[model samples]
Target chain A: EDQVTQSPEALRLQEGESSSLNCSYTVSGLRGLFWYRQDPGKGPEFLFTLYSAGEEKEKERLKATLTKKESFLHITAPKPEDSATYLCAVQDSSSSNTGKLIFGQGTTLQVKP
Target chain B: DAGITQSPRHKVTETGTPVTLRCHQTENHRYMYWYRQDPGHGLRLIHYSYGVKDTDKGEVSDGYSVSRSKTEDFLLTLESATSSQTSVYFCATQPGVAKNIQYFGAGTRLSVL
Candidate 1:
């Protein structure tokens, strides 16, 4: 069975603090890994997609790195605006060309000013 | 913020009642999907449409149905709403150019009493 798990269900960080959120997965064949940021009363916004181990992507203060069994979303000097629920999802090769995603219980981060 | 729009941003209905949520996108994306989000559980796919009149069941499709009669609109229906179906429902669209990237609309919050 393909499953995705995210640790540290909730985290409180001071403004400018750096931390990392983890996403671990067990899939038949890894196709893609995705990261999203969701704010209260709103939908999730796409962050990055990592396709292979050792792949990394960055945007401003956020950086995502992938491994064989897990991925990490590292927030560097996160601001209060960065406070949101971070979601991690995976797509397995077995899912026919339809592009179905299996998501993990998100990690909620609060960057207090 | 994608061009997707989900109608009935909030709804409250009784169990056994029929309910329908509408998703409209201006992006003309070929793929549309419905997902439900809940606490302690990640978003789960309910149904998806690959093209006009082409729809398929997803991991959590039971008790739900979907229709894509035109290129821009997709509708999700609950034949008989149940308390267990109360959730925040999100509609996402995948542009053909970015097969793995899905853009979401502000979710609809549904409550079944």
Candidate 2:
């Protein structure tokens, strides 16, 4: 079975702190890897999509990088506004262009002052 | 936001009751998906539709069904709600151009008593 695992299920950082969240996967073929940020009582927001190994993308302070077997979301100088649950999802090769995603449990980041 | 809206942002119901969650989109995306998010468990795919009258089951489709009779509307129904079904359900749409990005609805929070 295809699976995605996110590490450091919960991360607590001081305001302005920087850290990285990890997403590792084992699947037949990796079509894409995506990152999302979800706040409490809301849905996951689109972040970045990495299509292949060595691919990377950024938005504000969040940057995502991918490898053959895993992806990383790096948070730099996170502020309170960045406190949210970060989710990682991978598109399986079994799916066509219609697009389907397999997700991770998500890492909850709490940026405190 | 992609003009996606999920009805009954919050719901409380009893087990064995029938419940329907609706996802409405204005962008006319070709792909729509439903997922359940739970603590310790990642967001699991429940169902998806590629177009009107075209639907398929995801990894976790038990006790649930979906319909997409129009490009803008997707419905998810629970034949008989179970306590285990209480969760935050999210509806997402894939834009034609984004290979990995899926915009999401606000989500529906359901509680089964």
Best by lDDT: 1
TM-score of each: 0.97, 0.95
Candidate 2 chain B minimal-lDDT segment of 10 residues: B94-103
Best model per TM-score: 1
Per-candidate fnat, comma-separated? 0.79, 0.79
Predictions in order: lDDT: 0.95, 0.90
TM-score, candidate number 2? 0.95
Give DockQ per model, in order: 0.74, 0.73
**Model 1 chain A worst lDDT window (10 residues):** A91-100
Q: On residues A1-113, what C-alpha lDDT tens digit does candidate 1 reach at each position?
A: 99999989999999999999999999999989999999999999999999999999999999999999999999999999999999999988876478789999999999999
The lDDT of model 1 is: 0.95
lDDT by residue for model 2 over A1-113, one digit each (tens)? 78999998999999998999999998899888889899988888888878889998989999999999999999999999899999998888777566888889999999998
What TM-score does chain A of each model score against the native chain A? 0.98, 0.96
Instruction: Label model 1 with its docking quality class.
Output: medium
Q: Write the per-residue lDDT of candidate 2 for residues B1-113, one digit (tens) a residue.
A: 69999998999999999999999999989899999988888798999998899999988999999999999999999999999999999999987645547899999999999
